[model samples]
Target: MKKNILSALLVMAFGFANAQGTGSRFGIKAGVNFPNTSSDFHENENLIGYQVGIFSEIKTDERFGIQPELIYSTHKVENKFIKEGIAYNNDVKLSYLNLPILAKYFVTQGLSVQAGPQIGFLMKAEENGINITDHVKTIDLGLSFGLGYNFLQDCSVDLRYNLGLSNPIDFHVGDENYKIKNSLFSLVLGYKL
Candidate 1:
């Protein structure tokens, strides 16, 4: 199944790379992520991170297009709690390689709306100098919805919200299990080349 999915993605990429007109573009984007972890056990405290990526846009027409991105993003959470008579303050940091395939519809010459599904591959997870990758899931599924506006010289600004659809943790610390899901807001600047 994984091989089939990879093969389909490659075929789509090839088709986009050979798109019919001069409307295809390659771009770079970078931004911050405001991570909000919703959980049943732990309360999320101070969290901050950033994301950077590259994308390719293939226009199927004047009003519609497909934009695919390869992004490196961070998810951090300040988990403060007490369990088993021990107080713990855990600063969890996670990294992921996110693939977002967006369908874009232009509303005007400079504005568009985008919605997509994203697949995130977990790269690393750590908490307070301890490796916690074994307690975290390796893949994450999410949906991204956003708006974009183009500026002069092929530059654009995009604001998106990524809503995670799955629980990622499998283990508990000190007796408390968290049903945590990843939610993040993104504001990225892109320049086409």
Candidate 2:
């Protein structure tokens, strides 16, 4: 994750060095996320979530742009298990402050491809009324890639995938080194101002 962030910074710095001029625009975006955890116990579960945010886009050219966003995202996981011939259900909810830096390449006037890295800070989590801060850390790192279509008026639809690079929680019973991987898929609506 550290390496990814460093790479993004280097890329952005290089872009800035070669940039002729800069144009700034602000926009609003909202999205739905389908979340899942990668672990032995919860591999079968799928969770639904969402995100809403504001972004600042700095254009470098007709074909390239950089967008930085601040987003509020909700994530979760649901598990169903059978105990003593009875079914039990459990849900875990997580909230995060997500920052993503995206590099975009426009394929046409209306379509573009984007890839980026996101850093998330965990804000809150609840698990059956037990405080689980010790089980989780506040920092999360993820990679995101997506495609978007923009209308002539600057409204757009986006589809993105966010894959976790680090575990947000330490779920192992006794091993501090053990962690669980999480991921999300989001469909977003965006508008430029």
Candidate lDDT scores, in order, read 0.83, 0.75
Candidate 1 per-residue lDDT, tens place, 94-174, comes to 898888899999999979999999988787899887899887888889999999998996899999999999888655675
RMSD of 1: 2.6
Q: TM-scores for all candidates? A: 0.88, 0.79
Question: Which one wins on TM-score?
Answer: 1
Task: Give every collision pair in model 1.
Answer: none
Query: What lDDT tens digits, residue by residue, belong to model 2 across residues 1-193?
Result: 4564455456545554444355556789998988867754423477788899877667778998877777889877765655456565656778887878889898998788999998887767766555665557778899989998888667988888889999777653333243567788899998987
lDDT of 2 at 148: 81
Report how far residue 49 has shifted in candidate 1, in Å: 0.8
Error of 1 at 56 (Å): 0.9
